[model samples]
Target: WSLGLKGERRDLAPVSTSYYRVQAPVSTYHHRVQAPVSTYHYRVQAPVSTSYYRVQAPVSTYHYRVQAPVSTYHYRVQAPVSTYHYRVQAPVSTYHYRVQAPVSTYHYRVQAPVSTYHNRVQAPLSTYHYRVQAPLSTYHYRVQAPLSTYHYRVQAPVSTYHYRVQAPVSTYHYRVQGPVSTYHYRVQGPVSTYHYRVQGPVSTYHYRVQGPVSTYHRVQAPVSTYHRVQGPVSTYHRVQGPVSTYHRVQGPVSTYHRVQGPVSTYHRVQGPVSTYHRVQGPVSTYHRVQGPVSTYHRVQGPVSTYHRVQGPVSTYHRVQGPVSTYHRVQVPVSTYHRVQGPVSTYHRVQALVSTYHRVQAPVSTYHRVQAPVSTYHRVQAPVSTYHRVQAPVSTYHRVQAPVSTYHRVQAPVSTYHRVKLRVDK
Candidate 1:
């Protein structure tokens, strides 16, 4: 602690040898209270020392305690100083409240019984004029309702889509059903026609014939031949003969009476027979001589005859004329004539010699009175003829009737159906 003295004092000189006794004490006082006020006090005691000190308070009072010494040094001299402090402390009390609610439930109710009885008593007054007005409180709530229009509209859109899909399926089913039966029937018809179309074969035949003829002829004819002949007649003769005659009767020629021989016959019928009685006398009455007789009647000449009669009577020469007789002569006949073929001669005889020389004539013989005849003969033959001929032929044929058969078969058919669905909401 330091104290400043206001009164004059004297310093002691270095050479003075006197002992100085300085006693310094300083005291500082700090006071603080609950009122948050601070007070400070300083007190000094001299011989005089230097001192420094401070005090502070922010919200409330505080007590600060210090115990320390002051030190001073001069030219090697050291001084020791003393410090003092005084504190005044006032008692202070502080209060603080803190409350926190817990996780449990709590309820508090308070009712006074006097009020309850008074309230029950008022309810028993039925005829009492009681005007009660309750405040009009309206509560408005907003409720959202699900409308059927939205669901119906959704169903409508789905229905149109379903139709779009079903259209193609229905069309396809119709196409499948339309021509199936017709096509099968057409195919069966063509098959039947083919089955009925069968074929047959051809045919052939032949024949022939023939004929012939002939002829003949005839003829007639006549023929004849005849011939005749006549024989030739001619006469021829030559004769040589003798003829004699005697005549003259002598009277009473020769009577001889003397004869003795027998006389056979004598007859004198008439005439005067003079009997000559001179029988023996020579008779000389008369005698005559004649020539020799000629055989042919043609006398050429007389023959001389000499007779010897010697008696001559009256000498008378009786001369007789030549007497002649006629005689017929025979003639020779010839007959031989014949002719053949076509030759003929006709003869006419006025005077014919009627003599036939042969009994049976030759090819031509005849009497002496007619001409010869001729004969002829003729002959003929028969005839014949012939010819040739030909003829024609023919043929025919027939064909068999056609035959056929038919048959049919069925084909497989298929059907299809589409699936459909309906929804109700």
Candidate 2:
């Protein structure tokens, strides 16, 4: 039996017969016998005395509960998409390109290499593959140094197009030289088609054309065409025929003569027989006879005529008597008598006295005389009777002498005297 505890192991057995037999005092027997079993029965139910014992237990209290600490969380999410763009720099040379974006917003910045270079960026030029942005679309562009002093602006309205830009030009001056002196010219636009012409004397001129220009150079002058010269002159001569005949003669025969002055005579022979004669100067003289025996005679001066007869058959005659003798006598017989001149006497007679007497003076003078033929006595008288004497006797008789004596002496003496005178004188 064990003490009856609240939680103890106990054994129980059936109560046997011998039990109650021994009553042992509380300490009686010294020997401890470990009974394997004991059964006890008690009839008195009474309370027993108790002693104090210690006990340990888990405790239950009201404690506060803590949850996971609350913290602010942030999440990163992407915003709605937008487009940004930049422009490529354009070159001064010819340009080409392809576009990267269709609806992109583009911005532009200009940076020129030199101050003279310009950046035309407001309107981007169109290229083959890309178009310039509209309105205020921008680009980054640049330019190099320029060639000339003149400045130029980029034309607007950026088209989807491409073209070449020509260089700028300036005016220059030149002078003419040598023979071709003057020149004239005028200003022109960029493309000059016509040339200006110059005329007149030598002088300087200014000319310009439309375009860029270089320095002035010389050109050749135009050539001139000229005509040749000629010389001096004269004329020609002419002639006529051969007609008429000509002859040369002695003296002046006016057959032919040169042209004569006033009053000049031209003597010509007419027919076969005529004679032509010429005097000095313009006068000519000629004498011509026309009869059975035609003759042409020319007398130079004056002439006279006379005639004479030597013997008489007693025909008629004419006499140019001498200054001293004057007589007219005719006889029927032949006779002779003496005629006295200043110193001489001549004798003449003729038989045919019935005709008148005649005498011819061969030069200047003539003389003729006649003698008495018979003797007879004179009776009536206041007259004288003359006595005839012989040849030598010188005798004179008066009228008073006797007639008978005169007859006797005159007869004999006259007869003998005539015979004797004829013989002796």
Candidate 3:
């Protein structure tokens, strides 16, 4: 084994001994020697037996010895053989340290040995002589002793702490710290004081107060908030103008002038021929005009000339003296006179011859002839003639005319012979 006495340390080196043992005390110190100071890191090769040696000032040691399940190293403050004998036994295969200091107005802390698999702790103060042992299966603790005051805190995975004391000017406070699933604290003080503090799974519980608490207050959780905004916009408009007008036209057109005077001709001696023209109006029409005529006759007349001629004839007259002849003239009183004489006497042959002679006057006439003429004759001329001639002859002629002249004469004769001659040339 080795020993190190330094004012400050940076690292700890391992000191190994396999079965090397010793029978006396190992002492290593560093001091100013004019005043009291501390000692550090004294290691031993074996256990010691001496008890009466003294260091003239207070001492402090820090030692660590680690190995397997047989022996362990610890820091212990053993009193001098003249005061008391100390026997400390520790678990094997773990490292432990013990330190003790003299009476002074300073802070003192002690921690119990921790086992490797399951760590159990016992903490005691010098004057209070209170010893606590709890199975804090893998936990850590700190023990503190001040002048006339003591405090300790235990942090275990699943454990409890019950601390009770009856002192007027002394206070004991213990904390049992672990995961909140299985950790609780209970403290009982002098005057019927009991308090329990638990955390997790039940955040709020009830408590009974025998007396008034000096200060009581509570805190609350937090709250949240939000905000909103907006964006852009638009607009529109309309416009317009005015109105107008127009004109139209239609079909065909024609024009005519006025005409006057006489424009036509008639024979070679031209008559006054009036001029003709068409006159126009909304509906009617017009034209021109003329006159009438005459005649003549003729008449005719005719006149004729007539001529007459005369012829001579002779007759014998019986003029015998009336008395001589009458004597025997049985001349037949002819049947003409119807005489009744005896017929026998008349037959006496009286032959008598009578001759008659007649003389006629001579007539001489001169005739004047007249004829008619026409100036304008449309007819022919007509002429008529009448002629009558009578002479005693044996031939007789009869003429019947439209103009006739009649004459009568009486004559009686018994027998006569007469010759008449008539010539018509």
Candidate 4:
């Protein structure tokens, strides 16, 4: 029936097909549509099918897969994966992977973490360990880590410190005042200069002995030696001895007597007696025994007993018996004496007369007279008796009066007439 059927086939039924037999049948499909789709699609579908298929995903995933592909695949499929099973199954893969660590911002902190210790910072690639000592000291430590041994140089802490030490310099000084006698010292350091001043060697006063003194008199006397201390301090001394003395006289007539002293004695005696006369200047007079009146006697008459005597004169008379006389006479100009024979009643008489003298015999009995005359008279008469006869005459112009007569008469009686006359011329 090839007639026109109305088509309403809405059923879930099988439909039959018509085939045409062609003259030539192609053995392989040869066209762009027949190649099993491209290798890109297969590669994209590779992850969905196999139990161990790996996807060629991004390079990161690829790298992961290549490292642990089985484990990652099993894990993503949510299978019962054990850590030991994956670990046993995984290959000992060697990978040259470089892991970049965090970038190091090298920094340091400057701090005195403790008041007693010092802080220091070192160079790069250096490390250090610090220890704080209780007594404010610092200790350094080197870090020997597993990787490397780091070298560390530590500096002392910055802080204030104190210590007990000697002063910087040494010095010395000296001083002096007024009068200094001696100063002795030992110097320790270098000397600069020396100065000195002298005050006084003031004079000292003392005493000494000089010379011995002496004193003397006008006489030749020994001087006494004594010391006289004059000026300042002195003394005196006296000699121990006796001194001699002398005398001084006035004229030639000198009378000397012995004088006694403390040490010496003296004596006095009479010297020879001397005499002088008016005529002779000095005469040696002989000693005689004469009366003081006999030295001056004069004769007056010319008779045998009339005489004058000058210095000292004396006479002796010897006569015969009865009517005799004796006379001794010395005169200035002349003198006379009579010597008569033994009388048969006659007499012998010696007469001395000076100057003018006269004598006469009695005119009756036998008698005689001897006489002389001169200008001046000197006579000596004896104590005898004479006869009264005639008185004699005057014989001189200027005459001295005769001596007054005092008689001692002894005569025999032969009387005669006698005339006594007195004459003046």
Residue 376 Cα positional deviation in candidate 2, in Å, after optimal superposition: 99
Model 4 has an lDDT value of: 0.17
274-385: candidate 1 lDDT, tens digit per residue: 1111111122211111211111111121211111111211111111211111211121111221111112222111111111111111111121112222322111111111
TM-score on alpha carbons, each prediction = 0.08, 0.09, 0.12, 0.12
Q: Between candidates 1 and 4, which one is better according to TM-score?
A: 4
TM-score, candidate 4, is 0.12
* Candidate 3 lDDT by residue in tens digits, 85-134: 11111111111211111111111122221111111212110111111111
Q: All models: lDDT?
A: 0.15, 0.17, 0.17, 0.17
Expressed as tens digits, the lDDT of each residue in 316-356 for candidate 4 is 22221111222222211122212121111111222221121
Question: Model 3 — which ten-residue stretch has the worst lDDT?
Answer: 290-299
Mark the regions of model 4 whose C-alpha exceeds 4 Å error after superposition: 1-308, 318-392, 395-406, 410-422
How much lDDT does candidate 1 score? 0.15
Ten residues in sequence with the least summed lDDT for candidate 2: 231-240
Query: Can you rank all candidates by lDDT, best first?
Result: 2, 4, 3, 1
Can you write out model 2's per-residue Cα lDDT over 1-425, one digit (the tens) per residue?
44345765333432211212222211112122222212222221221111111101111111111111111111110111111111112211112222112111211111111112122222222222112111111111111111111112222222223111111111112111101111111101111111111011111112211112111111111111111101101111010111111111112211111111111111111111111111111111121111111112111111111111111111111111111111111111111212211111121211111111111211112223221112222222121222222222221222221222122122121111121211111
Candidate 4 — worst ten consecutive residues by lDDT sum?
110-119
lDDT (Cα, 0-100) at 94 in candidate 2: 19
List where candidate 1 sits over 4 angstroms from the true fold: 1-240, 245-298, 316-425
Q: TM-score of model 3 relative to the true fold?
A: 0.12
